[model samples]
Target: MDVPNKKTVLVIEDEIVLRDLIVKKLEEIGLGTLVADSAQEGEKLIKEKHPNLVLLDIMLPGGMNGFDLLERLKRDPILKSTPVIILTNLSTEDKTATEIGAIDYIIKSNISLDEVALKVKNHLQ
Candidate 1:
């Protein structure tokens, strides 16, 4: 079934350009984007917006890092169901990411933006 509402994506990337790039790619594929510069902001957006999927970066600079946010989401009954995909350079964190309930984890610098879109589509579809 076609999801009637736009599939919203909350992109949490500390780098402005990278965040914009990811958002643009998602938009190009007809997905809505919510960009956040920090995990704290991203977590707030998740609570308020309940986006369909989250493109979370593991290395956020804020005090509430991505791992912590992921953990909170998993523990919260309201937020635990939202799908998350972690995109980071730290491939070593995959086990932790999955343990925290991320649907998928992709390494940056190895995957292209298009690949990311494909991954999102696979989950959202």
Candidate 2:
């Protein structure tokens, strides 16, 4: 059963440890979460769930990287408005990610789990 008025965040990250930690922190803050290990899975979840926001990672295992997904999302009429935050290790791609339509770029190593959750909360509000 879905909870009424609850905001859901979709996290597209392949790292098991980081993904689990992100989900844990989000849950602790009373937000609903859906996780995907790849850009393909993330796209499917975004289409099906219509999450309020997305925490996307750049280095996915599948053929499509985060940039590809972000490009596709921005191009899609229905999904273009969805907020996406790029969470990855690549600091050099920040400009590219913003240009591609990610609302924010977070370098994974520079931020804490609490900060990530806080950012997500702020975006949802």
Candidate 3:
């Protein structure tokens, strides 16, 4: 595919390797990317940069988990409408993800990098 325009995506992931991989893929496809090692980091970027979308992980380090971050985003009228997609190995909380307005709950363990990029791009569009 041709490189996408400057659609920015915030990736909130704890695993360094996975986070880098996702960022690389997003960049390769021409989507501007931001990396946040935890939900707190993601939130800070959201407030400061306000990316077009976010790929959020369910489990994260620090007091602010992904769901906690989602709750915060939902409460903030300014960011409540920002699109969020849940990309996590934990599927047990799919219900909560849906209830909290995640555009999609992706299981990383069973998906390919290309597919992940495709899904993210689709939502960002």
> Cα lDDT of all candidates, in order?
0.88, 0.92, 0.87
**Overall local distance difference test of candidate 3:** 0.87
The sequence of per-residue lDDT tens digits that candidate 3 reaches over residues 1-125 is: 11245889999999999989988998888888888988988999999888888999988989888989998999999999989988878778788998998888889898988998999888877
Model 1's lDDT to the true fold? 0.88
Model 2 Cα lDDT, one tens digit per residue, 1-125: 12457898999999999999999999888988899999999999999999999999998997999999999999999999999999979789999999999989899999999999988898888
Native RMSD of candidate 1 (Å): 2.9
Off by over 4 Å in 2: 1-4
- The residue-by-residue lDDT of candidate 1 on 1-97, one tens digit each, is 1234889889989988888888888889999888888888988899988899998999888688888888988999999999999988987999999
Clash pairs, model 2 backbone: none
Q: List the residue pairs that clash in candidate 1.
A: none
Better of 1 and 2 by lDDT: 2
Q: At residue 78, what lDDT does model 3 achieve?
A: 97
Worst 10 residues of 1 by lDDT: 1-10
Whole-model alpha-carbon lDDT for candidate 2: 0.92
- How displaced is residue 84 in candidate 2, in Å? 0.1
What number of backbone clashes does candidate 2 have, counting pairs of residues 3 or more apart or in separate chains? 0
Which scores higher on lDDT, 2 or 3? 2
The TM-score, computed over Cα atoms with residue i paired to residue i, of candidate 3 is 0.93
* lDDT leader: 2
Q: Which ten residues in a row have the lowest lDDT in candidate 2?
A: 1-10
Sorted on lDDT, best first, the list reads: 2, 1, 3
